[model samples]
Target: MAERTILVAGTYDTKSEELGYIVEVIRAQGGDVVSMDVSVLGDPPGRVDVGKHAVAAAGGSSIAEAVARGDENSAMQIMARGAAAVALDLYRSGRIHGVIVLGGTMGTDLALDLCAALPVGVPKYVVSTVAFSPLLPPDRLAPDIQMILWAGGLYGLNPVCRASLSQAAGAVLGAARAVEAPVSGRPLIGMTSFGKTVLRYMVTLKPALEARGFDLAVFHATGMGGRAFDALAAQGAFAAVMDFAPQEVSNHLFGGLSAGADRMTGAGRAGVPQIVAPGCYDLVDFVGWQGVPRRLEGRPTHAHNRLLSSAMLDAGERREVARAICAKMAGVRGSVAFVLPSQGCNEWDRPGAELHDAEGLAAFCDEMRAACPANVALHEIDAHINDATFCDTVLRLFDGWLADGTLTRV
Candidate 1:
């Protein structure tokens, strides 16, 4: 509620003065500045350096030297540890309203370690040299993160970098002023969704989730998003998971572009009520006209757009996907339910489409029977995932789970 305190953090041992200049610019814009100097192996003399002591407090003694002795990897590990510790310290002390860092590649990753650790709505911005990675930046931000990268390590605060970074600082400070701080989820529930099919859910589920007096978090159905839900479920961040789009899991099995790390849908653990559905499992998505994989080239492929693609599953692939899905469902604790939409899972999976394969459905069901636990339940509905019936079913199951949550005894 008081004025926001911005945290400008970096390896101050070397770039102390440089970062200080940036901090001065931030202060000039009317803001409080707390400098977190994560000089893991070294602490340059600065008026307000706060890293060496913080790192030592977090369990590292002479962390900077240790980092220097080890390879850059080790240095980064120590630095990340030090930065995380410093950021947490500053955040808890109520002095850090936002965070900023400046460095080359090492600094970029190092600062990112801290920036990427925060929950949404805590203003975060980073200046990095490697801004070319095609993958989206970390999700520590509700709005997209602002990244500034230069080609070299040394500069006298060039006009472009200064303007860009100053803009970023202004953005961070403005965001802090305009927004109320975030409240972490209570009895957190994780849901997997895609921007497409599940977009309407924001209206339907957001209020219901908030009204239940529990925190509900929506995880994008990108490969990493699904994996994140599983990990969060395992972490007990939430006692229940509502998995709407099982596209990531299907991608892992069927060679889709969204195929991320394995164990895609394993949110049910030790008794978490995992109400799941193969929402987009109806087809695998690809990029480009070369959408069909070699194995499936002879099968059926549909061109959704100039660069986007979808493929119909034959009976065999569907069975394989079902087996994988069942395996994931079996990992959950207590009652695990995977609802199937018979009318259509995706646009291409409906009647009169190229993927209306009942054989595939039968195979998936049979596979679940063979692989899932006895307690796991399956409901086949005569509607698509967006249909009224499926949505209602999802909400009812979640409410039931909240009332009967047993995922974590503690």
Candidate 2:
């Protein structure tokens, strides 16, 4: 194997010793280092292959211009953009295999944008004081980022800081060395799900799709997972999409467990062949141990685990969510259809279940049918989401699309 190059980025003016130590550790772990300086206030402390001036220029400005303005916030933004451009160029040229970034609040903020500029498979590690904070929203976060808490990294080198940095160096380098690009001879199908109980039909659909030479990529409907699914789908990563668990879309609409503001619309916008389903749109998730919301205290609720609590959506909210889904799917250039399971949408939405709201489901179905565009087809199956019959119907429709030239089989 050839020597792998790792990009080490940060405020080299202040964290010079720390950045130097990181580079040394990555080299020890068999990774060649390419240093990038993102400092605006002062000169870098050591040798920087990509200097602040070059980075600033990549971001559409000059270090001199940024420094002359003297606004720390604005200056940091310019550096961040510059760092991202440098990283992107390096990746495109196959010069960098991975990235290890270090910072506090300011550094982490800059690193977030830099990491986002890279594709999903690239290894991105951030050693930050604010690794697990609400300050980093989904829109500002890269789904595959590996963040390590800067336990004792606030100041100069220490035993604690070294411990975290050493592990991070090994992790990023190891990932870069071990990971290879994804290859699928068959068409890739993106599917979304919450849990086995919600979309158990996946067990059946997976085999059927694979038998037809399609590669199935299932994504969990957790906040970050949904974002990754949407972002990747929009990037043309998937040939088709089985967007069953659109609960994240419902969650975002009602300010619940939002995947992000840009959840259900990506695959449609990208014109990917998609089969949409309201798999778990009947409920929105929240942290269970945190106690239920005061407004939803009286609504039907189910605790999937200590961390995940789901609340049933009411009739009005369900109708609105269905309308939103229809609005998103209406503009797809490729074949798109809604596979509505009339018996129930998810496990807890079945008869006698805690989240069973027949009235709400009916309202959702009505609104979807009414709002669904002429280009989009609606298939209402009189079976539960997890039922074999529903899976059969979905597979049959997909087969029909392939046969009719609506979907070109790979």
Candidate 3:
């Protein structure tokens, strides 16, 4: 029943009127608002609960020096660091319940850094002119940020801008009020897959894992989802990871969407028990509407939706990806298993399917077997990846890992 607090952060020196209006909207909606000024320029025109001077000091700099230098980029960077520190303090002290930020490229950049410091489950929204631009990379964006394109939100506030701001305020506060934090007393298992064609094993595997007292968290193998999974895994957020799809990993290597620099190796580097598979390994995803690369025009592909397309990999590419996976798994200190479905990686890669490439699969398997390390066990199954038999094999191996202390049972 208590009032929720929302942090409204922006460069008050330039966007004072807009930010002030947002604050008023939040307060009118029965929410407490905290105004943070991240400007490193001239004095703020209005009242700011958290001023630029404090922000500069928190970032290990002084406002006077930043202003004197007159460098927009340098000042913005320092202010971002300071704002993040202040926001973290506010959240820890229970003074802020959610965050709403608005800006062009500069404002959005600062907001991204600030929101990244807050843990997941905190509602964070941004209204930005560049929300859908390709200029912003996935790694630069916080996984939980809900962004709305700042259409008509330019120099001054208009009806269109106000509508966007008001809606964003409502969304953040409502989320903070209504959404309960996720509860799972059992150990969490992270799994990755794309669409049904690639990960039908989830239908049976999920309940089986739950019956054994483990909660499964599945990440779609989209570029962003894979990166988020890798980030969380590296943070030691899960006890084990079933990385059943490495398509995003291949996608990244080829400059496609959802590929972080360290996608597949996070669990291994964190020493978390991991069972890796080449689910959808024969495909790299791209936007379905985007122009296909001239070199890859002849490769087999499947359109999963209006937005997503999966392109088949050639034998050379498959071999390289296999080597990459092996090299990464070799250094794992935790228990690791490399499971490959011999018949096919995904449903689309099976016989009679357009993406089915036996030669490519053979090349990948040969490279994987030759390059797999002694410590990491490699299991080659005759069934397709989604087949119940394949899932059963994975479950059995998972149980063995638990019994042998490879994966701790919570």
Best by lDDT: 2
- Predicted candidate 1 versus true structure: per-residue lDDT over 91-185, tens digit per residue: 77777877777777677777666765555457777766665454444332223356765434365566666666677677777777887643353
- lDDT by residue (56-115, candidate 3, tens digit) is 888889888787778888888898899899998999999998999889999998998998
User: Mind sharing the TM-score for model 3?
Assistant: 0.93
TM-score of each predicted structure versus truth? 0.77, 0.96, 0.93
- Per candidate, the number of residue pairs that clash is 8, 0, 1
Q: How does residue 22 of candidate 2 score in lDDT?
A: 93
How far out, in Å, is residue 90 in model 3? 3.2
For model 1, give the 10-residue run with minimal summed lDDT: 135-144
TM-score of 1: 0.77
Reference-based lDDT, each prediction: 0.66, 0.87, 0.84
| Candidate No. with top TM-score | 2
